[model samples]
Target: MQKQDTGKKLTVSLIVLALTVLAAIITRLTGLETTSAKLIGSFAAVFLLTGVVWRFPFRFYCMAFGFEVLAAVLGSALNLYHYLGFYDKFVHYTSGIVLAEGGLILIHALAGRRHTPAEPLLCRLFSMFFAIAGAGIWEIYEFTADNLLGINMQGDNTNTMGDIISGTLGALTWFGIHTLMHKRQQEKQ
Candidate 1:
């Protein structure tokens, strides 16, 4: 990464760290123990992942981090999921986009290390499947949480199917945009 870019990321990370601390303080003060713990853990995970994965695209990292804070922090802390029926699905859908982009970045990074440019088709296929698999994994996690902990995470079959479909559509959205961008580049060449 460029020096300027690194500086920008550092700034963003610091801001997030501050937010995490503030959230912890506020939630604890308000007697929201669960929310406080969740926010701290979620922010920590995002911070560590982004910090460790230095090769990830800056834009993608920002988007991923933003969505996480939005979904995990704002959404949970504000009780958006309970109030807004669409919010949960929206989060799942956006998660698919983030996962797809993460997969693409991972493939590209590996190919770069091997000194071979990844084929476009392979990248697209990997990204799409990765996102779908991620969606499945998320649903499984919800199911496990519900069963093991007796939590109301996964509402029902309808909700699970809807989340998966939303995620698939999100992946398709990214795929379409990527294909169009690649086509434009090919045409220019």
Candidate 2:
């Protein structure tokens, strides 16, 4: 019975994931803006994965609700009107991608260290490396948009570096805080 239930859940999840992917493709192609497309995609992945995994309420909380909120908030940090610059009208999509990738690591740190929700400082630093690397790629994409695609992201090399710095700061801060909070809770218990 348990196996059958899991199978059914998996099937449903696949269907939902397909639908979500479809929506993302459509949005991206229709020129709905890249950042929006990314958030939509992230939401779909988290909700679908959580539903299919059949995790307990706590896991679901960490994976779906917590991660989604964190990703969105971190992503918004870079989209402020000031960063938008004049020509781009304050709309560039690469920031969201950088932030989303960082958020993913943060999610991993939370659930990845299930044995001790509080991973060591080294682990957090290690994850920060990946986050920073992903941010580098994101900057490249932004550069492509500005130079090749003629989108004028207003994010030249300096802007790209700034984005990377902010992304690293965001990821490291989130992870460090999470680890500290988790350890504190454990102590109380």
Candidate 3:
């Protein structure tokens, strides 16, 4: 059943990638030069990253990350962020959650069978730290792009601060849910 689900997810992800490619082509043909280039480059980067994630043993995490990337790219391509004021915040929050999941999966893989269940506190801390660090790096990238490429990736200091806060809150939210789920599972056992 899990394998079947994973297969279905992979198929959907592939379809999303195809659609993104089509959108990029359309954007290019329509003469939206800046948007076309940005869409194409973002799609390519996301596609390559998804490919790398696919190699990992954690199928679910890979799929989650792939979907998150696709959604982010789609939002950018369609100008959703411009139309919907909160769309950018949504993406940042989702990125934090997805990245935290990736961090947890990494820790799980490293722990191996010897540690069937790794230390919960350590896992939570690592995941939160990873999300926060990723958010910081992304801000740095936005700042650099805005200055060097003359793109306004970071609208203002308030926007930057809001993104960081949203990301951190997302990580904390994940931790809370994870703790609850773990406790529930323990109670069941």
The lDDT for every candidate, in the order shown, is 0.80, 0.51, 0.74
Candidate whose TM-score is highest: 1
lDDT string, candidate 3, 26-125, tens digits:
6567654346556866677556665666545555545565554545455666556776789888888877887788778878877785667789879878
Off by over 4 Å in 1: 18-34, 52-55
- Model 3 worst lDDT window (10 residues): 61-70
Ranked by TM-score from best down, the candidates are 1, 3, 2
Candidate 3 global lDDT:
0.74
- Best lDDT among the predictions, by candidate number: 1
List model 1 lDDT by residue over 20-134, tens digit each: 6666667677775356457756677666757665566788868777776767665675456776889988988888898889889889989999999899988988998899999
Q: Report the Cα lDDT for residue 12, model 3.
A: 55
- What TM-score fits each model? 0.83, 0.42, 0.80
Cα lDDT tens digits, model 2, 84-163, are: 34312212223333344445456565777685564455555555566667667767777777888788654566766666
| C-alpha RMSD between model 3 and the true structure | 3.5
Ranked by TM-score, the better of candidates 2 and 3 is 3
The alpha-carbon deviation from the true structure for residue 127 of candidate 1, after best TM-score superposition, in angstroms, is 0.8
What lDDT score goes with residue 122 in model 2?
54
Worst 10 residues of 1 by lDDT: 32-41
